[model samples]
Target chain A: MKFTILINEGPYQHQAADSAYQFAKAALEKGHEIFRVFFYNDAVNNATRLAIPPQDDRNITVQWAELAEQNNLDMVVCIAAAQRRGMLDDDERDRQGKDASNIHPAFRISGLGQLVEGGIQSDRLITFGD
Target chain B: MAMLHIVNKSVFERGTLDSCLKSSLSGSSILFIEDAVVSAVNNTAVSDKIKAELSSKNFYVLTPDLNARGFTDADLIEGIKGVDYAGFVDLVADNSNVQSWL
Candidate 1:
């Protein structure tokens, strides 16, 4: 089955991101297709490359990036939510005339329509949030 | 292709319930869990809206959540059904998709 996972909380602050990561990994391992992992609300923080966690703790952002790289996963961060939280890609940074862009290369910033589209296109739309 | 919309926040505490109700499709089913069970009670400020929505939507409150919050089936608003965890799972299986409104 094709599944779309929606994460609505930032990493570390909530267990939603971890639960979503585990579910996505298990789905892929079970041979199920993950259509997309749409990040919204505080979840856009997951795509920011600026976070630096201690050596002892798991870095969820890096984990997501590696998972996306290995599986060719579509990791999308909602542009509106990203903008609200100051998460920006190169294009957005240039458009907004910002000095830097913190978004990781593995994740792309897109509109909320992608989330609606994912809901329509995928077999299951599983949301993990606060 | 109906959707099962799960709300886990209280209506009085947050706009989550309102947003879920506003965004829901006509035939969608709404299951109130956790703190959202507070909205399923009778004679609340949002009871009128819930009753009105019942004309085109199916409303359910998680029985466990309701009980945990000290509410009974009799306290539920008219047309709202109390469902168990199995019923919640069944609702998810029955719907084409599940949207959790946080």
Candidate 2:
């Protein structure tokens, strides 16, 4: 099946994001293609390239990056959400004259269009949060 | 089929998720919304159960509602996930079916 996942949480905070990860793994293992993974709202913060977690912490940013890299996944973040949470790519930061850019390379900053495209192109679109 | 699960109630609320999850699903999509997104918090039993079920099917969680309620993606542990409004619209469009929980 062609799968599109809408991840709504971060990797450390709770199970939502992580659950999406597990399900992604399952989909891939079952030979399902992951169309795209869209992050919105507070979940958009997961794209921060500068997230600093303690050594004992889960380090969600790195984890998500690694997973996306391994699977060649399309990790998307909502442009609106990222701006509200102070997460921005280099272009966005430069455009807005922000102090820095925090969105990692593994994730792309885009609008809800990607989400719409993913849902339309994929056979199944699964959301993992409220 | 396109289905949305709303996690509206807080994770701690009594029977909030249980009722939603166990509701009739003859052929409906479920998305979690509201405070229930809190259940995605790490080590939460609710997230565990929900994750397990989602692994076998095509259910998903929403993210904007959580953000509006002040919940961050970092608060989630393993199962819950995020989706945008466009994704929601696509789901409704892709599938000729629809239903809502609360």
Looking at chain B only, the TM-scores across the models are 0.97, 0.66
Best by TM-score: 2
Task: List residue ranges in candidate 2 displaced over 4 A.
Answer: B1-102
Against the correct fold, how does model 1 do in TM-score? 0.62
lDDT of 1 by residue, B1-102 (tens): 699999978899999988998999899999987678999999988899899999899999988779978989899998999987556656765788788987
lDDT of 1 by residue, A1-130 (tens): 7888899989998767876787687677767788999999999999988899999999999999999999999999999999988999999999999999999999999999999999899888888889
Could you say which candidate leads in lDDT?
A: 1
lDDT of 2 by residue, A30-93 (tens): 5668889999767897787776789887777788788889889999999988888898999999
lDDT of 1 at B74: 92
What local lDDT does model 2 show for residue B46?
A: 59
B40-76: candidate 2 lDDT, tens digit per residue:
6666665677666665545545566667667776666
Runs of candidate 1 with Cα error greater than 4 angstroms are: B1-96, B99-101
